[model samples]
Target: MRMMKMTVYFDNNATTPLKDGVKKAMAEALEVYGNPSSVHACGREARLLQDMARRNVAAMFGVRSEQVIFTSSGTEANNLVLRGYFACPENLEKGSKLVISSVEHNCVHKTAVDLNRLNGVSMHMVTVDRNGIIDIDDLKLTLEKGNVGLVSIMHGNNETGVIQPLDKIVALCKEYGVRVHTDAVQTAGKVALSFKDMGVDFMTVSFHKLGGPKGIGAVIMKADIDMECHTSGGSQERNRRAGTENIIGIAGAGACTEEWQVSVDKMQNQIGPLRNKLEKGLKQLSNELYIIGESTNRVPNTTNVIVPGLEGETAVMSLDMAGFCVSTGSACSSGRVEPSRVILAHGIPADEALCALRISLGWQTTEAEVDAFLAAFGEMLGRMQKAS
Candidate 1:
């Protein structure tokens, strides 16, 4: 008789499990079927739910509720800012360039490409170092060239968990009077975040990356930023985004955000130690193993490991067979045969990038589970190395 392997989840950075409070809120919201646009009693109740969610999300970001614009996903939120901000005639004036980091999520990178290809907008990509941190000098030189309207960078990388020096980046951009945007999807609930402190013009976050339901994200814009509306329909989201709000997802996000500080404390106090333990165990398992961004300041729950002589997809399969859930890189970029673009952007060779694995912890991860995963990974790697 074979014993069943206990299921272990280490892919929280891809998408986290919904918290109990979020589930309860979403369940209650499901009963609210009335359209928020209508002025009847039912519609008023629906609108109240959305309004409450809006307020809760606003409180998490330390911003006014009016500054939060809900969108379908983080990708849509990023597009709204990149596309909508550039849509303004003033921003699109000749020679006005959009500066982005080379390691941005595909949403930001692809959108920048489309903006350049379709709209004839100028784009400059700042490179990153081996640790996946953006080069501050490259950014400063690009801004010095003049004609930059906005600078978009991610707060913490989803794949490598590397945290960028937003203070330095923001301060430099401020000196040049250029707008800045950061995708904070992976950092919002896990780290202490202050919109006012970061001093960015716009920030994007996805609820599902935390404990909220999917299909809902928010773009936190500074009060003074003038961005044109991309989607035109209803007057929802203060006319910034025009669509009937997703009440269920919003309710979940609201409940999740209401307890944001608690989650941050847990991540820092609980998950960080577990991640450190996993990294130490992985290094001890083999001298050939490498942990990406290990020395850099990274998110508490994420560890990106490079296992020599093994492909990430193969390891993912073997781990799945052993009842472990992990990821090769971003969930958005999964299924492609190519290596991670984010890793390649850091000057890592494509072959090494293909061998990388991202393990992200969460609120419920345990020491025993981490140890078990280490054992399983070690065994699988030994077998793969022998075969190679």
Candidate 2:
């Protein structure tokens, strides 16, 4: 039973392929080699390109250009938000406490731990239900305890694609005079997101997740928030994230975000149907198979399936051999064999969490690709079951 080698990427949650617009933008930016921080003519040209990218990103996220701080990656952006706010002497004196949802991305989760371990920032985790929705009551209870400086919750889970009740979470945090930060790395381009509407004090987004080049991410903050810079050196990014701007990556990010509304529309109208089709096919293959966030409101492009008695790593490798790409969990934690902590946070058994598979679609994902992936996945499961 030999399977043909055909590439069908279902790992959009990990990273997406670069679009033509992004490639064109990056290609043009490569020729602008001037340092944006310099005052010379070449410098001004580079600065112009970088500023255009900032404005495009700001417009896409519905924020002012000045409020977006560019960082090396989503990990750096998350670190900046956590360390910048909590490291300030006044903030640390007022409240050294930080609260975060249990299902946050590794960048957020790991940074909070590091802050607590090294900086004495008291960390509290708000629990989530089996469907990966945050426990609102648990969050409220944590807030009531007081001395909480910030609450960082992701807009959407990277593994489950479960959208948190951010509006409610923000409102509660505001009542307690606590600032809120959401890692919108997974939600920003896949759905209609508004920084003003969500009302969170800060948000983070990664460009690679939106079909842009890697090594670029942004932190969207309110103009009035007095946060310190984590990467201190020259006065770049308005002295917030001090480093030479990644002009090329920024150009790609800018191009990807220019048509944000179009991307959202396609995800809703076109990609969502294909995702539903994929889930249906998965279910029909095995009665024991179940999706993690099926009934809950999730991002339109992701599906987290748990196949009973099958290791997620094994499924991923088996599918890879057939040229279908999928994932067991976040790309950050890909090589680890342990069950997903995010999935375990949902109260799923550890054994079942190990059986999880994440299939994330994108605007480029077509019906034929979805069908091919489904066929390949079904074949892998058949072979596994027969051997067992």
Candidate 3:
């Protein structure tokens, strides 16, 4: 006589469960028993493992090994780009402005806010369409105002999963002689990412987004770009990021990178169908339900649906009670009860944003899981409507 566990995770955009084999590699890394900075044999062993991980992850993203600098998380990687550039004492005095998209991750958005408040960093917010696509004309107009040293945007949005036209954005910035950086955390393992081919000056990725361990991620910078270090302490990350490296976490990330394509293929073939089925089923349940970025190109794993007449957080809680995991907005801001700023950025009414429910799928999702979520969601909507 046992009770069944109410668990069906659909929030991969927030974070993913560790990939198979990552645990063993990370646990073994702990036994290395050496500081990578030391010059002895034990230290060399740890350094070798660290080098191997750096090379493996770099190879996976089609970038040079030297360009990758590991950070504590995707958040740090992002802050490194936003804050690191502004850390230059002379740049702040020169009034170098940072142009950020309205739909960017909070790490980027909030860091920009702090820089403007603390330092004299000027900030400009670019606009996005209803489909969550960045407006190139708006960006061009902003850059034309001058003193734009760096432009920060994301390759794939975490909330709506809308894939930005990075190539276009990069080209546009190049014409204005500005460096471009993209938060590519949500793109890994869900789509093919060629860091160099994308033609971006700076791009970052999260290990956990690719089914690797959490607290380990990297920012890939192009050659000739002077990266001002943010985390200062003893020399590490080739004198880029400071403090002791997360060796165990990096090892797990390397293991995941070694077999990342298995995840990509699974997302395309398996998870894509599940998403389509889920969307189709939701449509059948109610015509009032529609996706935020439905008409645009998005990663196969994410679907941000706005269920009219129901509060998103309430729907998320009801589904959680029904053995499913979904989110009202970005997990970084999950504690807040306000409507999604990303949705509001689309120029929709504030009330529409209150109905947003972001359900992201992953490699481990199955057909049965999708069916169960759809059924539970339909029932909840039916009850909510009936009571109304």
lDDT of 1 at 16: 82
lDDT of each model, Cα atoms only?
A: 0.90, 0.90, 0.87
Question: Which pairs in model 3 have colliding backbones?
Answer: none
lDDT of 1 at 177: 85
Using TM-score as the measure, which candidate wins? 2
Candidate 1 structure quality by residue, lDDT tens digits, 273-315:
9999999999998898999988899999999899766889889
Candidate 3: residue 215 lDDT (0-100): 94
Estimated TM-score for each candidate? 0.96, 0.96, 0.95
lDDT agreement of model 2 with the native? 0.90
Task: Give the 10-residue window scoring lowest on summed lDDT in candidate 3.
Answer: 329-338
Model 1: residues >4 Å from true position, as ranges? 1-6, 330-336
Query: Across residues 1-388, which tens digit of lDDT does each residue of candidate 2 receive?
Result: 9856448888898899999999999999999999999899999999999999999999998889999899888989999999999978887776789999888898899999999999999999988888999889988998888889999999998888999889899999889989999999999889999999999999999999989989999999999877899876998988888889998998899999999999999999999989999999989999999999799999999999998789898898898888888899623346657888898888888888889899999878999998888888888888988998
What candidate 2 gets wrong by more than 4 Å, as runs, is 1-6, 330-336
- What residue pairs clash in candidate 2, if any at all? none
